[model samples]
Target: MSIEQSWNRITRTLAEHAPATAKELLPPAAEADVRAVEDVLGQRLPVELFEWWTSCGGGLHPVLPHGYIPYRPIGSASAWREWTRRHGDGPQKGSAAGLPGAGWHSRFVPIATDGGGYDLAVDLRPGPLHGCLFAFSHQWGVAYPPEWSSLTAMLGGVADALETGGPVGRYHAETTRGGMLVWKL
Candidate 1:
């Protein structure tokens, strides 16, 4: 299904099963805000990610929790800059050279985190990896190949897992107080 369809399914499920948590989602991002992020990053965000921000502005939601804080466009830019500053160089020379390490590539923009210093990011660099979704950890580095081809697919998988009680890879569907469904690791 399309990203809009996936978003609809996700929101509908959340409203039905976890209304309270759904209410916590941030307002849709403004176009200007998205532009601001692009200005900061010095490159445009992927179409899918732009669509996602415009449709559902990043915020706390039933499917994503604290460590998984979704980034508002501006927030994402700032966080990327900060992370680069703190971890620009690798711990061991050549150990993480040219790979995703302390100084992550400029093309990768963090979209969310696992609350344990790991991040879910969008790879915006050119070539084959463009638009791919990745999972990165501060300690372990990039988690192999791309996890999803696009943000739409990733969100769709999350929606599917929420609807079927199926696993979304390492995460599982979990319900908390007030019958709210969330993805838990």
Candidate 2:
């Protein structure tokens, strides 16, 4: 399925079974906002990411609680701001070189944050893994293999997990007693 379709299914599932979490999703971002971040970063967002942001701005709170880390998708502006504020010049401590993992690399776009030092980023670095998604941890750095090849795959996995009660990577979809969606390991 297309990214948009997968996203729709995910949102629909959330709306029906996890209304509280569904309400936390942000509105679509304006075109100008996306452009502004691109201009600032001097990097173009991949088509899938662009499509995603144009349809869903991001999140106001953590929606995907993968394991213990509660990740919330971030808008372009927030991504750029975090890049500037944290990345600075080069890779940080515990960063793996040339790998799209935990580090302060300009090519890595911070698409989601755990509100801690860790992040979920899009790898812009040239290579086979370009455009793939990986989880960046402050302590562990980048996981060897990418979690998702693209935003499309990630959304599709999420939708499938919700529909089948399956696992997305290591995370399993679950609902709280209050009918809120949560992904646990």
Candidate 3:
């Protein structure tokens, strides 16, 4: 299914199972906002990500019960720049330096965060890994091999888990609060 269809399923499930949480879903982002993010980043966001932002602006959406806050337009641009400064090459790499192959690069753009320090990013580098979803931790570094091949696939997994009481991609269903299910590591 398309990301929109998958997200719709997730929202329907949330509305049925956790009405209050569903109410927290943010509205779609404006086209101008999305364009501004691209302009700032000097890169075009992957189509799936663009669709996601245009359909559902990044924030507290019920679909990601794991607290993965997808960055808003400006938030995304700023985050990529910040992560690049801290983890990308150069002397500013700082603490992230000398980590035995653990560091961020320019092509890896921050998409969502667990509201802690962990982030889910899109690998925009060329070649096979392009468009893949990666899990990045400030404490541990990027989880190699990625978490999902595409954002659409990841969301599809989440929808499947919600519908079947199963795992959501690499994460497992942890608990439920007020009828809202939460996924965890």
Best lDDT among the predictions, by candidate number: 3
Best by TM-score: 3
What TM-score does prediction 2 earn? Answer: 0.82
RMSD of each: 3.8, 3.8, 4.4
| Preferred candidate (TM-score higher): 2 or 3 | 3
Tens-place lDDT per residue, model 1, 1-185, is 77667777878887887787677778889999988888888887767878877877877643553236677777787877866666545323433212343446666788876667677777776655567777667555443357777777788887887788787767886778886666666
Which runs in model 1 stand beyond 4 Å of their true positions?
Answer: 65-67, 89-102, 138-144
User: Model 1: how far is 171 from its true place, Å?
Assistant: 2.2
Clashes of each: 2, 2, 0
lDDT of each residue in 2-24, candidate 2, tens digit only: 76798789889989888877888
- Overall local distance difference test of candidate 3: 0.71
Give candidate 3 regions above 4 Å deviation. 61-66, 90-101, 139-143, 174-177
By lDDT rank, best first, the candidates go 3, 1, 2
lDDT of 3 by residue, 1-185 (tens): 88888878877877787676677677789989998888877888878888888877776642463568767777778877877777766222232312224677766777787778777777776666567877677555554457777889888888888778888765765436666556676
Clashing pairs in 1: 67-115, 87-102
